[model samples]
Target: MSDKLGITPACFTKLVQDLRIHTTLTDSRFIQLEQKVGFLLQALRHSDGVRKVGHRFQHSTSTIAMYIHEVVEAIMTSKLYGIYVHQPTPDEPTSGIITRNPKLQPYFGHCIGALDGTHNVFAVCSFDLLFLHLHAGSEGSAHDQKVLAWAIEKGFQIPGPVKYYLGDAGYTMSENIMVPYRGVRYHLREWIAGARSSSRETLPSTKQELFNLRHAQLRNVVERIFGVVQRKFSILTGSAPEYNYKMQAMIPLLCAFLHNHVHINDPFNRSTGKARAARMTMEAKRARLEIIYKRTEEALQNPAVAVDEEVDDPPEDQPEGLSMEATRNEISDRMWIDYLKYKDGPRRRQQVPDHLDELLLAFDHEGLLLR
Candidate 1:
């Protein structure tokens, strides 16, 4: 059954059971809950149109469309979003690569998650066209910044205490948002090139370059999440259904919630062996995290660490004065100094092995050593 559906049998059964328990859908006169859920998942997993789904399920196209709407509404109204979406607390200890890297954790400890918008194109019928023209003026493509601004204007709770989402240069930096330095090598590819030719390439020569390198590394999580979603759900990568614009918008959110659900609850992924592996991973991570926390505590206890005495809240009504450029500059300067200290520290000045030094000298004579 799992092979047939492209989802594990347990997962499919769990989803059906969840819908039965949560939604108002019962055995209808024409269709049962299993058939309805199957129809919707087929369409989403395969990007099949209503006509195709109706033919496969032996139902009329309109019936298939109705069932899809019912399932989508049920999924959306469920508690998936609240259960799966997590925001890190301000005082939470840092983890993952951030904890492993001495240079980045202190600088970006307040970052919870990375945020970015993706464009999803759906077909538009004449009715949708007319409606969009009348109400919202064409429903054309929207930029990421514009969508963020609209979300803010609509009273979305922007997380804070300098806990912000990492955005790319496309976004405007604000009190609650952090972006890479403008007019600098900001992309992962640029950093990769620099790393591959570290001896030859000028290494993050300026403060802005170092900041952008670190920013790009952290912000890459958002891209990875997007890639995973697109790969998991063909509906997002392929052409979506010709639903109304509002319904189309809801599809991405529904897919995201479903992805999170499967990731968290899949039985096969949570077997005893996998559980052991996960435990081992966590233990190793915990060891690293302990070292980082101890170092951080020592640094905080040190009397040499300067504490900021001023706390000035900017005027909320004014837009111009709220720009985060000054704050970004200050952070860049501190990061630059921290990087210099790390480079000149005793750990970096360790004596090289005689064999390795000979090899390096040979490479230098052969013109293989980077300038």
Candidate 2:
């Protein structure tokens, strides 16, 4: 096959070999991956708006899609994001593991990337592969839990103990990933509310209030990552067709890889980080949270457990980004929290209200709304 207009044949072959990916190509199928990757990333950043050179190069849709897939696969396999899991070693610092060279981290340990799933909408594909397991429709937002599971199983699985993912209630707690703040009825919005209330100086704590503030900070990171993706790639800004799940799945991963690439090579990306960080700073973030509370704060009788007035509340340190397991899964086959809450095996028939009290308190807009 002829090479892409700008790339030499040798470089083309090397790029394909380096990617170790197979896909259908256009008449000029064997184009260098550098050229192909360049075009695909360009699409991710939407540099050309709705169309790019590939659109001008006259490649068939199939060929363009193939190149895009190959590039995505390569990025998924790459460890450029510095996301990895590391185990606590005998010589390791006990508190707050230093985020450093990912290469040295132990396989499957503590420094795991905190991943959460958000839906990515996309245009429909011409021929949907009915048998393909990946495309089951429903846009990507079926649930954050499923997204984390799929992500872990994909090119990257969550690393173990040393690295656990920090996600929200949307994700079910897993070994390598932790969903802190037990299915808080309120999440990003709650954090925003807490921040706003606290801005005026929230009363320190009854274990619940303190713990709530602590987890709020930790969970914000995952949300920030999602915001970055949507902000950078507007293609993900729309709702995807329910029929094409392949494109749906591709959007998030593609955007993620694009963000990482831009971070590495784009000069503009340098300021992007600094600017976003500044925007994400606590004060700014609370101001940006656009949540409309759902539950009304009608207080039911408090639990028999008294709020120990003199217990000396724990320090308001950032809550560790770990789902506090009621007990290890080994001790209980059910969702570990069910075990922690009750030793008896789970009965799905017995439904528990998700963060009921919390939801009511957080989302509910009775007297709490600011004038």
Candidate 3:
């Protein structure tokens, strides 16, 4: 059941037990809480249509839909947010990719998490589209920046000072948010191509280029979050469930919250141990690659170092008088200086030769290297 449902059996049992203890639903009125939760999980994990879920649960499709909605609402109203989504304090310890790479540590030392918005297809009737356009206002076609602006306007707590989330170029860089430098090779694909190319000319040529590369590296956390969410909840990857617009909006949010819950409470197993070991090995290789790149750059003695470029002023709609262009320039300058110092100070033993760079560059954006 856990294998089919994409969660550990213990996790499923714990979730059901928690919901039974906390939910307002009485066991006598509807199906058992365990079955309700199981049905929802199966539907989410397999994208099993409501009809199929109803058949599996031995209930009517409408009953299954109602119970699923109730379960989602109950979970949302529970302590999931408090348990999983708490903001990190300044003194919180750094881990994961940032800690593994020295180059990334100083550059993204203060970043708490990565921020990015992904669109999920929602099934909406023509009448509901009008309602969404007028009330929700995005009509499922809104830009990431626009959604961010709305959140800011609605008093969403933007990070302050040293605490921030790494965003992509679509967002405006601010005191609490960092974005990639505009008009640069920002994506991992572009960086991989440059790294693998025979021409040394294809490598990052300017301070901004280097900054963008690092920015993309750190900002990828959000992409990984999305990937895991989709992999765990196949309903998100498939066409949206036949729910109404409002319910459709809640689906992703619910899945995200559940995803975080599962991640935080994941029970260790042999597969998990193997995956962790592989990840650590990959991070070590990446650190070595960074060292090699630093050595190569230093050996080449490239004179076109860290030139400050003029950044345009912020647009009128920018929140809190934040100048994204100015923020990017300042951070880029800092990164350039830090990288130069890192390169000149100490050399780690290279894991791969400079001539065999393609072996390292064969990976795609997600760090999954091709054979």
Worst ten in a row by lDDT for model 2: 123-132
Give the alpha carbon lDDT tens digit for every residue of 89-193 in model 2: 333332232123121122112332344333322111000000001212234434444443453354343343443444444455554444444423233344434
The lDDT of model 1 is 0.55
User: Clashing residue pairs, candidate 3?
Assistant: none
The C-alpha TM-scores of every prediction are 0.67, 0.46, 0.73
Model 1 clash pairs are none
Instruction: Name the regions of candidate 1 deviating beyond 4 angstroms.
Output: 1-6, 58-60, 78-81, 85-103, 120-141, 193-202, 267-327, 344-371
Alpha carbon lDDT of each predicted model: 0.55, 0.37, 0.57
Candidate 2 — which residues are off by over 4 angstroms? 1-35, 47-111, 120-163, 171-177, 181-186, 194-203, 239-248, 264-323, 326-371
Ten residues in a row with the worst lDDT in model 3?
A: 125-134
In angstroms, how far off is 329's CA in candidate 3? 4.2
Give, for candidate 1, the lowest lDDT window spanning 10 residues.
124-133
How many collisions per candidate?
0, 17, 0
Q: In TM-score terms, which candidate is top?
A: 3
- The global Cα lDDT (0 to 1) of model 2 is 0.37
**TM-score head-to-head 1 vs 3, winner:** 3
